[model samples]
Target: MAIFHTSIKTFSRGKGQSAVAAAAYRGGLLLSDFVTGQQHDYRRRSGVVESFCLAPPDAPRWALDPRELWAVAEAAERRKDSTVAREFEVSLPHELSEEQRAHLAFVIADALVGRYGFAVQASIHAPGTPDGLNHHVHILATTRRIGSEGFGEKTRELDVGPSGKVQVQWIREMVAAATNAHLEAAGLTDTIDHRSLAEQARSAIERGDDLAAAALSREPTQHLGKHAAALAGKGVATDKASTNDQIAEENREHYDFLVRKAGLEGKPAPVPGHEPVKRGGRVFNAETAGLPGGLELRGVSGVRLQNLLLSSHGHTPEQAPISLAEKILDALRDVEEISRARADLAMEKIRDALRWAQRQLSSQGETSELRQWVTNAALQVRALKSLIISRARRLLNVKSATRLRHMAEQEWERFNADCPPGSTRYSRSEWTLRRGRRLSVLEKHTAELKAAQERASEGELNAIDADILAKAELLAGLPHPSVSALRIAEPKPVPPDDLGSTRSVPRGPTFH
Candidate 1:
């Protein structure tokens, strides 16, 4: 991808700048400043690949020539500290051919002319060195609108607090859009984004594309201008140059690590002192073995939690791919199928990592590091087991309760049809009492679910709470399901009724 960079600045006499000299240097021309009667000789200047001027349809003929245009621009501004011209400097992608680059420059120049009615003097500059990729264009635009009569009032809207910031942003976006369009037309996969790195990263993550997100998560380097760049080119380190080098290296390492971590690359990411462990003629992680994020004190379920988090973010469950091992286990009636394939691969990697840790404990001698690692690893493993068992139990109990509720409903239907309310089978008062007791138990489960809400993380809640919540609410909303009660807690026997009834409903159905 190409970098998105475009900037606007002004040549102000207050800042000791001359529009005539600036334009001459950019266009490789020799011209006199009509204002100061100053002759600026830049005809010997090299590296200019193209230079031209663009004017509005109603502009005077003199505005069409770079020399005449800037001369008039300087003459038009008379104050000692007057603002002379506005400049737009944009980098051109080295990936484009010369003709394409020139065409892009024309598009940008035409846009400026159409928007501001300014006479635009543009120069496309070659890189300082043939091997360099610093190809770019410099635009010197007049502050006033050009007409057949002459330069008119200054474009005050370009000031900072006014529409200036907005116009500059539009230019940035325009560069990005136009560059991408040309790249696509050229059949090049490279493109550009006008957003900041952080903004791009968030967008990628929101779309659930972590790989692209990882690439964008990197810190971008600072630009080194002419002097600092020259010094750095000669191998002298400057502060900015050093910082840029560090950022570039860090970005490279981070991207490489993420790619390797995500299993997009088979080669393990580099670590300062760690060496690859060669075993069975295969490369071993040496650190994680196969774990996601080497030595992380988390179980495979952590990956599951990540997927759950994604699902909780308004994404469909199918869009949040839980690990494949989970999928395979679910394919064994573990849970509903998820469509994501990335997590499935991550799951198998996690299993291998766990076994590796376990083997280390069995084979290696005791040490402080090993002890700490084992302690964390053991806790994660045990917690994972407990989590699995707890989920399985909850699912089984809810399923049983559902069936029992169904049975109870059927019994009520049958009793209502055949055995009337006043029939000898069961008294209306007794049925009402039993029904109230069942509702009380359902309320207990509902309370349990509600309480669990406070303790559960968003991940666990989405993964487990959804089913439990739905089932609990379903049972509570229905006429008390079972005669005995839900399996949540043991049922209390009914006390002696006023009619001298002593039979107790069996303690809630027991789950193995």
Candidate 2:
């Protein structure tokens, strides 16, 4: 499928990013960073199909060269922490030939230069080896406007302020249009969409296409980012990629159920609404599989019908035996159970670390990295729990799956009702992360209160004291009194234990 992917990230000194090094990696060049006094050489880098630099008309001649361009760009920023550039990543259709993909990239680049008036360093990368659908473009753009006189004022409109998201939406729409135009010109029927799956589903429903709406209503796959995609190309699985694969399997199983339900009801076409079955659900078309035209296959099961279906297509008997679907489901369930148990144990360790980190946060002068790590770990746990629930959903029928969630909510409520006082009335592992974040905020306010006490006038001190007291009560869930003397102990580093995995059992005739 021609997928739609557009993301814009910043090259900012505050985030430890350098435009020169980024350009080197994206364009596969060897460049010296004047700002950092380092040489970045990516000339030996492979898989870069094409790379070029774009300058706005009337820009200085020196702006045409990427190395000099980024040097000037970094020097132009006066702040110790300033945004050097912005990168726009756009995915190209693998259905298009290499030349076609390159052309599409150029069109998108030109549109961006005209819109933003920045020098664009664009690179077109070849599709990934394992899965060939990752063909994409990397466009590094200056954050400032440029013209005949060279770089001008910062493009504050593009910064994450009032108009930032609106500008991003315009870029997304423009990219989608340009991609579809090129696909149409190349005589390809497949077109990409910029809107989310839910939005697309709503549009389908408005157009009175229930089947298309139902298909579109399924949750889309999570993005396998650059690192994860590279890992996948090397045949290494990531938690994110594994979760996406499981979601895809569940979607297919649901679609297969719809097909069977339609067949059993003697409908001309499959719509939606049904109980999903096991994994490895493969759809066999009557025309393609050489079955009788309009033949219903709802009740066709067991070894005999399975063989007939596979024999018509000349598929290997091991490819998709009827029992293999159930076997794969059982295997997946086993993997899910094992994974959930491990994750729950890991969650306890994370909670303990979180509690320690929160206590240490007040004393550490340089805890930005630790704070970010804490946030990332919390989000990771949330995603892990979601994937586990999704696995359970895939194994059960519709009502059972829905009830599983409702029951979970009820159980959590009951837990809270039975929990002792001084608690947050929530799951401790989840509350641990929340409390850690709140502790950071409380410490900030406490410091502010002390600082204000030292320097503020009477009126200002009174207001500051009131705000601090409220903040301490709300943010820290602590009692009144003793706002200062907040020195805390340092946290010792303890490396996390790596997780192990159990592979899914392969399928063959076990004579089920």
| RMSD of each predicted structure | 34.6, 28.9
Q: What C-alpha root-mean-square deviation, in Å, does candidate 2 show against the real structure?
A: 28.9
| Worst 10-residue lDDT window, candidate 2 | 293-302
Model 2, range 1-512, lDDT digits (tens) per residue? 67888999998898888999999999889989887799999997765766777776557767768879988998888887899989999999977755467657876787677667889899887555444457899999999989888899888889897699888877887777667656756877566778787877786688676666676677678878779988986668799999999998998887787667667877544333221211245454333232222212111011222334455444554543223223323323333333433442323334444455554554553344554444444434444444443333223223222332333344345444555435855567766554554344345434534443344445654654454344323322321111111222345445444554444455887775
Poorest stretch of ten by lDDT in candidate 1: 333-342
Alpha-carbon runs more than 4 Å astray in model 2 = 261-512
Q: List pairs with backbone clashes in candidate 1.
A: 323-343, 324-344
- Give the clashing residue pairs of candidate 2, or none: 58-148
Error of 1 at 94 (Å): 0.9
Residues 1-512 of candidate 1 have per-residue lDDT tens digits of 35567888998999999988999889888988777788988877656766878787567768877768888888888788999999999888877755567667776777677678888888888665313467789988999998979899888888787588777766776666567556655767566667687877786688666667667767778888888877874557899988987998997788777757767555444322112222233422212121121111122222222233233334443344333233223222211111121122123323443344445545663344434433433333334344444564444334333433443344345445665556764578876664554455445445544444443545764676455444323323322212122332355666897889896656887799
